[model samples]
Target chain A: DNCRCAQCVNQDTLQRNFDTFAIPKDLSPQEISPKNDGVDVLWSDSHKSHYPWSWLSLTLRDISHKKLANQEKLWGATIASAPPEVRFDDVMSSTSPKGLADLTSKIRQYGLCFVTDSPKTPEATEKLLETIGPIRNTHYGGFYDFIPDLALADTAYTNLALPAHTDTTYFTEPAGLQAFHLLSHTPPANKPADEVLGGQSLLVDGFHAAETLRKESPGDFEILRKVKLPWHASGNQGVAIAPDMAYPVIETNGGNLHRIRWNNDDRGVVPTDIDVDAWYQAARKWDEILKSKESEFWFQLEPGRVLIFDNWRVLHGRSAFEGLRRICGAYISRDDFISRWKMTNFPREDVIASNMQLR
Target chain B: DNCRCAQCVNQDTLQRNFDTFAIPKDLSPQEISPKNDGVDVLWSDSHKSHYPWSWLSLTLRDISHKKLANQEKLWGATIASAPPEVRFDDVMSSTSPKGLADLTSKIRQYGLCFVTDSPKTPEATEKLLETIGPIRNTHYGGFYDFIPDLALADTAYTNLALPAHTDTTYFTEPAGLQAFHLLSHTPPANKPADEVLGGQSLLVDGFHAAETLRKESPGDFEILRKVKLPWHASGNQGVAIAPDMAYPVIETNGGNLHRIRWNNDDRGVVPTDIDVDAWYQAARKWDEILKSKESEFWFQLEPGRVLIFDNWRVLHGRSAFEGLRRICGAYISRDDFISRWKMTNFPREDVIASNMQLR
Candidate 1:
């Protein structure tokens, strides 16, 4: 993409702003509310205006500058200051000297964590990935872009309500954990973005989606097992996304969760199949569960805060929003994330994405 | 691809022309040399050039039709034709009925065939793929001349030569066999006009390359099995050829024949654990074999006759040249070729490339 942001000078300033959003100075995975009956997430005020369906859309666009102002106040002048690790639940909140040790245990069992008070700009996103460890660069077809392309960003393509989905289930080994730094939110200024609208960060214990599908649509699923759909994009705007690999939409293992991957837009139609109506219908049900609000947790990922989810088990998504929505993201493979967590002596199941998100 | 051709306007003329090129019309696959050859193929005298390297250098210039007229007499009009499922080692004599049958049988196993005294223009190339089977449409990708865009026929910008190196390899299942109708073999014409010159059709047998590698560099070959390399391309086009599967450059099965897939430009650098330098040396030797005249049997594929090859087994290339070189290609899967081969009977090492020449 010939977008301006690829070389945007504002990148550094933006990342610095994200560092001040909400996290503590010292970084380590710590469970925020392990004993609580439920998880709590809030959205910021500027988060709700960017959606096409939102009445607050204009408000978000109008206050874009103000949001950045708040961002600047919280994040430091440097984006690379992001901490190495974070804990989402109360799994590692122990005040004892062994807190870090307990956290390491949790991370190994689970596969994700949430860190607070991280900056939310693109610059901050890069910094977060850097501090944590080596990040796996993507192959978006042939060429890759670290930040979202302009058209993709302008539409708040990120803001579009994404269903419960993993990032690259289609890959032989999907990028493991993904981190999103929220620099600005649309509504309830300090609340999670989902709270501003009917949005939520949905994690379908892929375990559940898999078991359910296996029992309910075994026959239909078999079609995928035997089929190879040709997926290709003839050079489109100087980007060559390689053709699709023969991965199934749903993959399983003996473990608690099976990796579920489905991006409808990216799903190339199977050319040789006969009467795919039933298969689509069966697949639709699984999608419906993912999109429903009841299944997702809502929390405005504020500035200085980052949420990392397992691409395999924790399916993450966003809700409808208004304004210039922005959240910077970085990806780390599961093995690397785990290695980092353990090296820091913070292993525990609570730090994992599937540990608490599923039944 | 939307270019106007006589077929769109005149079905009779198209059919008449098609009938002349039709397989088994004049002979059976068994009767042809190395039977079971033929389907998508063509060879012509019109496309032959006094200097191929010169043709590449003549990109900006057009050739005089008078010169072509003179060459036409040397190579008789409608030199020869072939039937479906053609092979290379089979065609003994052009006039023999058994010649076409043998050629057809070869194509049955191989996927393509060849002929002589055919047209070598773009219009002729397009018609050839259209006539053989189905035309798999590719969007503009610097390859085809799209509407409002000339000089570049581009398609899905998916880059990174895929190992297993088949067209649409990224598809969960792949697309069929591809046929390249060489419309102009300007070799014997003129050389390229560039600083670097060499555009010769090169074929690398993966099976042979793999066999040698396994026997000589097993560890290096083994390293490729575990390591995943990153590859991509993007600029004014978008093609996502992401697949979850990857195979080593050399694969050995029950047959000692090693399957080779070497896309020198697309593969990422080898990992440290692997003896990349040594592996490259061995691989280079394999490449040399691919470029070897003995391994490659060549002839200017011309007019009424066509040539086809199995995209899976036969890796093809050309000695890069300067100027405007035109070849029209279309794809058909192995299954399609197989279906036709079964209609007759499998024969020899299978069908291969085209017509007669000075040799």
Candidate 2:
């Protein structure tokens, strides 16, 4: 009942409002302050005392395209908006025999998918992970509640704004795929009571951006060899996760894009090697493209809906909003997802076919 | 007249006062107050407030090899206490023409020579850099007068204790050979009268330890790839230098031993990957051998003594003591040294024969 795909929302009707949006340059983090200006997290204690104000000049701008929907030939942006329909494997009464098969297919095809009619707690998320397989922990900060935390103001425990970036860009093998379910979020601070409020989640395909970086500047990409950027997430005592040593944020292996930690809140400092500066610039340029508004998208993920995404190709972030917002996440390896999909004869093409007619 | 080689300082006549020693794990920075321990110059102001301890742990162990003189097998260690001799071109005018060629041959054969009765000043060392063709700032960290202001102590410009390590470990393409002159150093702190009492220097053949690491445990030697240890030196504005990246503390390349940084101070956290852990264990195992009293050669430098050695195969540090220690350094690319040595028919076996004799 919640899906409003081509058949449900009548794709033809919204196809009129379907002008592709540009990718966003900046990602609105869950919330830095209850008021929404900034955040103060655990590392903030060390961050505030050691770094100078000169380092605060942040530059995150958008460069997303608006020429066509991602599905368009050659010019499409992303096929990862709300799915066109609910896929089913309804043979067994115990589970959506087709549901597992369909969910696996959607992730394989579009790199991400939304789930509805599920519990919204961390415990439920963990249970869901059991059904899916193994989940790797790649969260930079936490199993984000995404909901605003009013208790810890800018005291380092309070959250803050973050730049849009890939996760674990510094690791030799980064964790793949991410799932987030919002349990609670207070509405934004300044919104009008009657205004149509929403928390739009944003996803950028890093796989595509890596290709763009390669095509435009191979020499620049090679700069990653001499560079070692810093990243940190040791704000709290309970959790301190980041690569053990300095590592590159952008990596290329056999033409495939591999990323390490890219969350700005976790970054320490950029290296001083001149050879490395160019690659950081290249990474920034690629990020700028993802920042474009036209290349971005969203569908309100209300409770009972869980979105599973390929952590490698697809980058994720959230929109500024009012209302209590909460999201819990779990991770699984790519091999697991691929095997799950192959077990069901790969029905990604079928779902695309059914949705194509509705469009 | 400056150098005191085998004939100059024998076991029976050796000044048994100074010996080789290791750095301890809990020593405080000799320059900074306990209050600003973690107050590194590169960190944001806010970040420094939390960490009260300096990021570094220092030790001061002696490095004299007089004890090995009896073992002909340790002829290499016998010369550890050899005095360094330096010669200045203009200053040599008063001497016989035979002096120039004789000293040049000594340098070519021994890889180091002592020049005495030469102009002794910071500028004299700076001039040596100019004569060497080009001076490469391996690390962007600006050169400081050995007598840096006390306030600049917070900026890595003071009488600080350095860890046992080599230079250019952080460099992907390191400078070749270097010369650091004692430009300005006053007496030791508190022990104002003890100013001239201490401040001896230490040097070890990176070639020596590297060969040992290779022969003893090649598996541990390969662990460096997994342990891209963290390092930082950003006293200079807009500069963050990492002294250990691609090169290992002990490496074997082209049938020759190569080493970069040796100080555990700059080499921060070890990587978390299993391979990294394994490599860490291997390097540590080899280090046990490297730290053995038998393998090290140590000595101190007198003014006007230009100590030149291959940065690729030498690890150097200091035995911190009374008064402030000051030194000026100039670097020459290994390529230039090689080119010049080859052009002049400088016997490759002579200019700087390895102290690494088969023992």
Q: DockQ score of candidate 1? A: 0.02
What does the lDDT read for residue B19 in candidate 2?
Answer: 13
Which candidate has the top score in lDDT? 2
Candidate maximizing DockQ: 1
Candidate 2 falls in which docking quality class?
incorrect
- After superposition, the stretches of candidate 2 with alpha carbons farther than 4 Å from their true spots are A1-98, A117-125, A135-146, A150-162, A168-174, A184-193, A224-226, A238-240, A333-359, B1-359
Please report how far candidate 1 places residue B12 from its true position, in Å.
Answer: 41
Estimate the TM-score for candidate 1. Answer: 0.36
Best by TM-score: 2
Residue-by-residue lDDT tens digits, candidate 1, B1-359 = 01012432122111111111122213322221121322221223211112123322221132211121111011111222322333322343435435434444554333345644445555554553433233432222212421212222112111111222334322222334455555543333355443333344444444444444457667655644334432211111212221223345554432333233444433322433456455555455555544454445333434345556556556655443444445555554333333233222322111100000000
| TM-score per model (chain B) | 0.49, 0.61
TM-score of each: 0.36, 0.38
Candidate 2, DockQ score (0 to 1): 0.01
